[model samples]
Target: MTDSSAPADPRPRSALPLLVAILALIVAGGALWVSYGNATKLAASKEHAAVAPPSDPAIEQIKETLSSLQQAVRGIQADQQRQAERVGDVQQGISIGCDPTEGLSTTGRAKVALGSTERAQHAG
Candidate 1:
């Protein structure tokens, strides 16, 4: 009882194009991530290389001399401090005994004066 003009059933479409698009997006994202990481590493290495080397040998010598000069200045400052402390100690301990006849009796002073006069007379 089928007629010759009956309608045909619809066929299902393949999802291959959608799957391919998803795969392409994943590949692109992975490539982008790898490129970004490589760029960062290259930039860091360049910066380190740029800073690690001196342009001239004279610059290195000058840096060494400058450090030695700083050390010498520190040593001189320490020596000066020690000298100042020594001077302070000497000043604190000092006393004067100006009288030549100190710790002598009056008779001893007279005898010394007489002896000096006798020596002066003999020399003249």
Candidate 2:
């Protein structure tokens, strides 16, 4: 008599369809992830291009203004030096009765005033 309680084929043909379906799902999911990732990168690059301003014109304007200010400062310094030299010459030549302390105080006060005005103008 045949033994009826024997096990069926361990490699069941029924498993093939299940495996194909799982593979298809995995492929679809991967395709979606790649598309979304590319689209996100494209969007970020577009936004960056839109927001960043060109630097050339702004840089040139800054350089021009700096040059003008530097020229003005040099001119003023030359004038101040000339005036100080004249004062020194007068101090050496004129031995008048004017208090030496008063002359020095006046010179110091003038220098302080000039410096403050220059600073205030630059701060503006």
TM-score of every model versus the real structure: 0.42, 0.39
Off by over 4 Å in 1: 1-51, 95-124
Cα lDDT tens digits for candidate 2, 51-93? 9777798899999999999999999999999879867755664
Give the C-alpha lDDT of model 1. Answer: 0.78
lDDT tens per residue, model 1, 3-96: 6676564565779989999999999999999999999999999999888665688988999999999999999999999868755554454444
What is the Cα-based lDDT of residue 25 in candidate 1? 100
RMSD of 2: 12.4
Local distance difference test values of all predictions, in order: 0.78, 0.80
| TM-score winner | 1
> Clashing pairs in model 1?
none
| Candidate 2: C-alpha lDDT | 0.80
